[model samples]
Target: MPAIKDSRIIILATNGFEQSELEVPLNELRKAGARVDVVSLKEGEITGWDKNDWGTAVKVDHTIADARVTAYDALVLPGGQINPDLLRVEDDAVAFIREFHASGKPVAAICHAPWLLIEAGLMRGRRATSYHSIHTDMENAGAIWEDKPCVRDGNMITSRKPDDLGAFVKAIIDAVEENASARVAAE
Candidate 1:
């Protein structure tokens, strides 16, 4: 992957985010030259989940209430049973996601993170994939769900689990790069 000069990426996560799911993709995106911002429901550090135990903490760059979708080129949602579950209940988080999608920006969610999409009402008629447990919920939300490593439908991308982080990151970087090029061409 090449450095994505001038591109900015936002990862929306909270406490209980799958450890590897957030770190791996964050590292990859940085290596690819995108400025990554870890945004959450609040300021301060957010904890990660490492399998059965708690993992490291990542500092939150901005709170959900302060995030402006127009400032970012892409969005990432890292999943854990608790992270997205908690995020979906926050009106601000859900609204932020809804605005990000409505703005036609690239949005990627891995594992259970797509639950935010369901909560934000952005899944209708869109094709997506998520951790196996939420397939039905995605279907119920009106999305054409698939069981794949990664699925990119329009500006949204989704993956199944931590194992899919590589694919998930690649899809998001590609989407952001493509979006950048398209915007440049249009201008």
Candidate 2:
């Protein structure tokens, strides 16, 4: 896929985010020449959750209070049981995501991160996928749930789990590039 050289992507996460899910896509996006930012509920650093324990800490670039949906071309939500679970209840985080979705920009989530989509009420009637444990939650929230590695419906992209990171990241890049192209054509 082509690189989103000038696109700006934001990964909205917090402490307890699945380590690989957040790091892999963040690295991939930056490597593809996109400017990626990590936005969380608080300032400073957010820690990650490794397989069975707490993992590395990542610097937070922006807090939900200060992030603007219009400043980014895409939004990513990385999943870990605690991360999304915590974020779903934070009104600022959910509203930030909702505004981003309404902007028609690519909004991608992996694993349990789709929980935020459910909270934001953006999954209704959209085709999506997430960690198996949340399949019921997603379905109940009105998403057409699938068991695929990656699924893209309009500007929303979702993936099953860490194993699907490669495909998930690729899908996000593709969506951002497509959105960029469309804007250029419109201009």
Most accurate candidate by lDDT: 2
Tell me the deviation in Å of residue 55 in model 2: 0.4
What global local distance difference test value does model 1 have? 0.92
lDDT of 2 at 176: 90
Candidates' TM-scores? Answer: 0.97, 0.98
- Span of ten consecutive residues with least summed lDDT in model 1: 1-10
Q: Which ranges of candidate 2 are over 4 A from the true structure?
A: 1-3
Q: Which portions of model 1 show Cα errors greater than 4 Å? A: 1-3
Encode model 1's per-residue lDDT on 1-187: one tens digit a residue: 2336679899999999999999998999999888999999888999999999999999999998888998899999999999999999999889899989899989999999999999999899999999999999999999999999999999999999988887898898889888888888788
Predicted candidate 2 versus true structure: per-residue lDDT over 106-139, tens digit per residue: 9999999999999999888999999999999999
> Scored by Cα lDDT, where does model 2 land?
0.95
Model 2 clashing residue pairs (backbone): none
